[model samples]
Target: MQSNKTQQGGVLGVFPHYHWRATEQEVDMAMPAPAPRPLRLNAEPQNLVIDLRRTAIVVIDMQNDFCAPGGWVDHIGGNFAADRAAIEPLQALLPALREAQVPVVWVNWGNRPDLANMPPNQIHLYKNSGSGTGLGDPLPDGRGNVLEKGSWAAAIVDELAPLPGDILVDKHRISGFWDTPLDSILRNLGVKTILFAGCNTDQCVLHSLTDANFLGYGCVMLEDCCATSSPDFCTQATIWNVKKCFGFVTDSTTLLAALQAPPA
Candidate 1:
């Protein structure tokens, strides 16, 4: 009889070319997870798991200056509609987040009364941008003033009023952490995860989220509750960068659902 190898014939059509064999270099899909880093560098392995106990919702720059009609964004001839649209979603989300016992923080642009700590560059931007009330200048139509620390424009919008226990942080710069008590407050509260929602997605919201991520906080962006007066592409780019690099991107509904779900 002929040897088996000598008698073998191959078929033209075959479902599998060959049986798979594990090589020494082959990856082990079932390998145990490696130890997490001492600090969270990036928001990879996106998990919607939110611990309401250790989490806080940061409402960034939802002030009248950015969100309301007679504010700075509108002062510079920018359309405030997008910023206005964020209000209802925030209103819907705030109550649930508060009831769930998640801390709420309002971070808004509240410059010094005498413009002492205000950066010259920032002041320049506000001055040359449009023909409206400048920072610390009274609104022409009497809607308080713009960018004065305790003025109506610097306050959180009336619609999303801060409740009794909510944290209020006044920031001089776009990033709330700069020259403000925001970081210390979050640290003191033992907060590890930050849920970011507010107006001007490409500016204040983006800046604050970036700083939070840099400071090692796990960031979850509430997509629907953030907006910008810039072109729609800016908002798109901000969300894209957030999901791709800084943090997890989710909307109010998904976040509410996550918060409502019982822990595993």
Candidate 2:
């Protein structure tokens, strides 16, 4: 499938396709898992079976700039309505996932003031730091680890800070898998499937989803939980293209249904 999306007011474009697959030669490694999580559900004939013990929820960049009013976006000034719409849904989803005892990985972005300390820009030209901050911040629970992407600006947004016990996987590019231990962490946790939800659907979210598909991890995108600079077109394209290529499309309610089932 081919798609054309203009996000962040056409500043960011999203192109998603489904024709990619992981090769057999590349998936022979089994990464160790985090300690076994309590398994409370089984696969029903109609419902999906998830060994919660082997699943992970990756919450991407739900930061202050994107979610909170007048935080960081005031500077860049893209789409507040669009970003707000995205943050509201995940706010609800996180609690449900936590109740079900599923692992939630917070993907944060941040770097130093000097551009020289970062990976060379993927878009060709180097970009300057924006107030030295990422849009989000670590949730206060101490469970969330703050993964800084480009500069200090990359921490989890202050509005939806990660909780304690949360794992922080830092990166330098749009795709979280780039130069990050995220892949190994998921493998080690026996996480065969990934539940993806977060900010900027057009950028990091989209890239990560495609990469995840290439990595062969089952992806279930929580639709309402993620948003972009454009509330309508970009958001819609993200949901559509991601469903078409990277993984399945779903909402928080559907996810809860699958997770609440009795043991298999």
Candidate 3:
């Protein structure tokens, strides 16, 4: 008997099962899976062991319109300063995650210029009185159109600008998964566990995490990495609902320590 080894061409997709390598004569679909980078972290409800190879950090609505002064939240008289709490922790956490090769996904409210895709209800969420600066409307400060795509209002905050390889998903609704390519992008990247962090913890972050849970992704809410201008009770309820219903809750401190700890 003679032994034959298959030699194939370039690899295809991110994950092993979805990837294929083809030569002029043959195609090899048996690419080996990447080594798992597992990190055990202390979390509420229970501890979690996540594979960095299959995990992504989803930072939701950490945009200028929500977090910075002279932006939408500030214009609407919301305490934008409160939302800034997540900024420092995320500043320290994201770079570390990127260093560990974990994907960073930013899901922010970047609306269509004409607001054509936005439903009346969605627009009403921001502009309840039906008259005032809302989605796509020019800000009184002349900074840019409110949350319009390609505007400063829609950009991530200066302190946390996304790196070249980071993924950005424009979301019109509270749930980033709705009517967006977010789920598809995660699926293509072979992401099974999502570490959620961003502003308005009781609203956008919580809703997005819930949607990810519904779609069967493992969700972990990084407590200190999420902030909201809402009242303190709101944060408590959001965290409770997350641990009781949607997913586990953890903080950046625990995660960062786990990431930096010597590999076992």
Candidate 1 residues lying further than 4 Å off, grouped into runs, are 1-45, 129-132, 262-264
lDDT of 3 by residue, 127-243 (tens): 899998888888885789999989898899999998887889989899999999999988877789999999889999999999999999999999999999989999999999999
Superposition error at 82 for model 2 (Å): 2.1
User: What is the C-alpha lDDT profile of model 1 across 139-190, one tens digit per residue?
Assistant: 7677666877788878888899998878888888878888899988787555
Error of 3 at 37 (Å): 1.6
TM-scores for every predicted model: 0.79, 0.68, 0.93
Task: Compute the lDDT for candidate 3.
Answer: 0.89
lDDT of 2 by residue, 131-158 (tens): 3323233324232222334433345555
**Candidate maximizing TM-score:** 3
Q: How close is candidate 2 to the true structure, as a TM-score?
A: 0.68
**Candidate achieving the largest lDDT:** 3
Task: Locate the minimum summed-lDDT window of 10 residues in model 3.
Answer: 1-10
Indicate the worst ten consecutive residues by lDDT in candidate 2: 11-20
List residue ranges in candidate 3 displaced over 4 A: 1-9, 14-18
Task: Estimate every model's Cα lDDT from 0 to 1.
Answer: 0.75, 0.61, 0.89
